[model samples]
Target: MKRLSFFVLSIVFGTLGLSFVSWSCNKKETNTIVSRELSSKKTYLYEDVPFDSTKVASFFVKYPKLLTFQKSIVALYKNRQYHYAWFDKKGVNEAAEMLYNKMSTVQEEGIQKNFPYKTDLDVIFQNSKTYLSPNLDAELLLSSLYFFYAKNVLTGVDEEATKKIGWYLPRKKLSYVSYLDSIIAKPELLAKDDKVVLGQYYKLKEILKKYRLSEQKGGWNPIRVAPDFKSIKPGDSSQTVSDIRTRLFATNDIASDNKSKVYDTDLVKGVVKYKKRNGFKEDEVITQKHIDEMNVPVGERIKTIIVNMERCRWISEEFLQDSEYIVVNIPSFKLTYVKNNRPEFKCNVVVGAMMTKTVIFSGKMSYIVFSPYWNLPTSIINKDVKPGMKKNKNYLVQHNMEWNNGNVRQKPGPNNSLGRVKFIFPNSNNIYLHDTPSKSLFNEESRAFSHGCIRVGKPKELAYAILKDDKNWPTDKIDAAMNKTVETTYSLKRKIPVIIGYFTAWVDDEGTINFYKDIYERDNRLSSILVEEE
Candidate 1:
């Protein structure tokens, strides 16, 4: 509601904080130029007034920055049968004012770029005499502004650009033409920001405001730690403990600082909370890496949040509609099986190593293979199998692998590379969730040792959870199948959607914002692109 201050058509022109662009128009032109008609009647109904369709092309010729939206504008007016959207017989309608206010203050949406035609737009609403009258420039500019808000605040960077940043999730396509219809029917929809963006984007926006406020107040000083600082356990006492407490308190990680040089129980709670919120192992011991995380500049953290907000824009809304689905956050190395909009189960996972980064995409998991054979891909065969065969006489026999029709395949057993089970999604990347014989790899803090496919730590538990409601395969049957040497496949009656997403920053269900290391070095790349676009 506070943003409505900009909606007043009579507001002083200079107060808008942009230079004005003056224009002269021919009096004979029909909606192709601004008209000073003081007695123009204002009407609330959109269909009551129609503008010349040919003027749409001339409007773009004047404001070239908005030329990109020319086609969308044409389609929008055609959909409305060339009716006036932002104006009525009385004056500028409430919807146009709302859009103008939003466009004026897009910085709150984590967009630093200034609207290209901000000055030109400000001139139309310079005074009630001009804004209240139906002006063709104002009508077309408001329409262009709608799309600007849609792209920056709702849809984010283009789909192809997202792919360049390694985000493979399907982008949500929005038809602003139809969206505008809904907003006009209920102008109150403009007040609900979350209605435009994913709820996650709104949460990040809230945190971004907090971080910006903190930055204004001189964000926390970096905590000092020794180069060889192995760790400070619960009972340890050192000056660094006091520094850590102060740092945590600054970020609301701890209830109070206490300013004590002791790693007391209170500090342990703060440490554990901070660690958990940071995608670290929930531990009271403060390690060097933890201190480094705390020392990260507040500016960098703000950028990370904004970058992830862009990513949230790319996620399809249909992802939230599924009764059941699985989400694997590659940076967090975590897999969560969600059902009915709640997390059913969560487990640690090992993603692809740096050299062989896992592909980010979505797929429908329609089948599960129990006691599956590890069909090694050609890349692995040429790189690992043939080299081993050349070095040792019985390399295949020693590793429980055999040549099957000129291809190497590991037998289905405890030693099998794919361990006991594999969840198949049938993607071109040859990536799937599977149990791994190298189970100990999951114990590592940063688990990214796998060749490509994800290695689930608790494969049997996940299998049972997925088949819990199915009468054909109970927990016992799943266990029996997992233990058997023969490979068995079961088709699921209903496919579960699996989304492999990469997010360096995410707000958890508990409302705690979590930050993870950019394992694939993607955060900066995306952040740079966003700033460049600005």
Candidate 2:
């Protein structure tokens, strides 16, 4: 790798905006002869030349608008050892053309940022002969353009912007320098699915297209019904039933649209499916609430899907590389344990309420504590314990709480706030997954009643799964540990990655779109930012 001697930002060219003519025909003729000779000898595609760093610095100085990508372009040249990546002996490489097309249609990729140098780039692409000679300006411009596209489409909004909107998840880190090296080696990769972005992003993009098409078709009509209608059950006949059938068919919740006026078995099945997808109870009964949800404008749903797509952009492809991981989606109120890239099991979970919203982040679950004590936070103690103790003098004894080192802590028992076990992943947020004493809360469709930590609905099953590989802790031993009065901690031999995320819209494995209420009103905040920018 050759290093550039000249500072890219130091030199200034006054005629940068003026378009330069293509290289002379004599130079093209000389390159043509050299190209034929190399092809006839069956040697390398293009001969490597010593890259002049001074020329690259001069190119950047000419187009100061592209100075933001100067460092990335320098790294790219170093990786390629000063070789021309976008140009071969014959002409401009296919990868450069594909990249230009991708950048031109970035809006189709859900990017809102306008490219400042797009007009200059268009001039370069339109002139076929400009790439015949080793043009440093064109080469560096395309390299900078690649980085720009990678940052906007593959990476996402900046970290500072996401933090301003309350997203605390670790942003995905990628080296565009190395990525460009790989692309230069194999130009065909540009046309293939690179798997650079999250798989969910492409899925949501497809759904977004479908939704926008629906919106263009004037969207679906709002279901009309009398105010007195509290709920509609199976076997009921009304005009609202026909409207519901049409709405379900439009959304592909049902296979065919019979336009039936009666709430028959098909309609009941569709309603149940729709309910389950929307985080509602899987029941045959349809209430006014369901009708209201269906009445929401299609444009609004499209916006929600787009907002969630932006969230997906923040996730890295490295997450899919892990063989075993746990994902807890806050809005969905569900915990999924995936093994071998397949979901092993999913269980209901209770997340933090709006006032005490759960933090979005990732951690390594390295320990599980059985028969755990509920070490109440100071806020909880001052807010709830003191108030209760004022009313009932025996509050501490009745709740099995004791004063420990001048702080209140609940003893391990069936009635303990942290039921019988807790999964620990140390972080500054002081959040962990634990079992709750109130089991009935899991039965409810919406379970956001916790402080900041997550509550597992099936804690015993989770314990068994986490320790199933360890012969020392069998199923019976696990149960015994949970039932014991003494708190026992087990260090996991293999730490699983746990990711807590917030997505109000998700596509399931069956291609069904699931929508949930923005429990913390995050979607609106993000949507407002995106709209304001637009």
Candidate 3:
């Protein structure tokens, strides 16, 4: 495509907070640019004028902190044949101003630190008239800043860095050089396109704005609970109710705060909303635990949202767009089966406890096993079975376990830890979803009692949902298969992608943001990495 004419480019830049000044290049410079452009095979989209190639090396010397982006910067200019991407014969282009504006409000995107050389950027844009013609320093600075924004806001930490921090789900890799081409063609998308970043990032950003606004307003006061009471039941009159009302209203959980001491209907509605938003049991009763959750400072909540936003960057928008898939957010203790870009069902789940934390990863679920034998891992055998066998001769028989080929395997039964079914998505971590005999564990708001695999509270329902379209597996056959003493396995015709992820803050379907406890204490570490990068 031909480069946007200077008149059209001027209008675009003027709209992005930078007035364009038409520059009069000497006849000699114009001829040189045309000769270079004609010799090159690629079409120009941003500017035809090329900058000095050696200055890119000097750019790193002048702004060494942005040296990390040197590779991407070099590739971008090379792709454009060393053209002046952020400038033209008119002045600094629209894409440059858009990037500058994005960096200026970087914190709004959950970034905590300013971009390196932001002051230098500010001076150049502030004095755009002085640099109306192609300037090497401004050109390279914009290129470096684009990569910085792309790294922190678009792609997040590198895959190795994420794996070091315990995130193993596939990271989305993008060609920032190609992305710059598209952004230069249509600069408005840099500010408004949801596809550029994960849709979840934008949703979390909306919540981040409200929370930051709440922080600015001094936040809500902690709801004080009475020492004598375990929970404030409905219709109970107390000051705690009044405080909760104020707190809920402050967070927009309720429409308004009447500030009444009585546990009225409005206050009860707000209580359930607050509980639901905080990944607690949706109930009218207000307990000390709920009070403690409410007492968590808004600043800490903001940090959690910011931390999860970084996680969103590690994800691909296209991954979530798959026709069918399953995702389990460990911190939220919930699993969602999505089909056609909508959640088919969301069920409570028990993830691995703090000791044997479930790994965050992705796999393709290919099989379903009913009345599955639980082949105890070596760790479990060493930790529990060997000691139990030493303590009692009948331990294996009592637990309905047997030695099968030098491995301890629990027989298919109601009391089996695998319950009556298991969904297998082969991974190196050996983590999969399965039914559990400990159904009561799901009753607790914090359900992290498993060893390392996920225990689905509604495995049968999940099976039904997965096989609803299939003609071969009827409900009666599925039920019979689970009740049979012999283990039965069925391979799915179409393997579903399964992603086991961790997010402490998520925006729900109703547009309300939810905050769950950092079950594995991951938020602080991730937040530190982001700040350290800054």
- Writing each residue's lDDT as its tens digit, candidate 3 over 137-212 gives 8888898888888887888877788899898776775677877766776777677555445566777788899999
- Which 10-residue window of candidate 1 scores lowest in summed lDDT? 17-26
- For each candidate, give its TM-score against the true structure: 0.88, 0.86, 0.88
RMSD in Å for all candidates: 11.8, 13.3, 11.7
The lDDT of each candidate is 0.75, 0.74, 0.77
- Residues 101-139 of candidate 2: C-alpha lDDT, one tens digit per residue: 877777666666766778877987898786676666677
Task: Name the top TM-score candidate.
Answer: 1
Candidate 1 C-alpha lDDT tens digits along 1-534? 111111110111111100000000000111111112222442235566688898889888889989889889999888778888888767877787787787787887789987788887787777757666678888898889888887888788887898887666666755677777666656666656443455667667788999999999999898887767798998888889999999999888899978999999888888988887677778777788899999998999999989988887776655534657777888878887766555567788888877778888888899999998777778778888899999997999999888899988888898887889989887777788988778787777788777678889899999988998899998989989998978999999999888788877776544567787788998889888898898
Ranking by TM-score: 1, 3, 2
Cα miss at 35, model 2 (Å)? 27
After TM-score superposition, the amount by which residue 460's alpha carbon in candidate 1 deviates from its true location, in angstroms, is: 0.6
- What overall lDDT, based on C-alpha atoms, would model 2 receive against the true structure? 0.74
lDDT of 3: 0.77
User: Positional deviation of 187 in candidate 2, in angstroms?
Assistant: 3.9
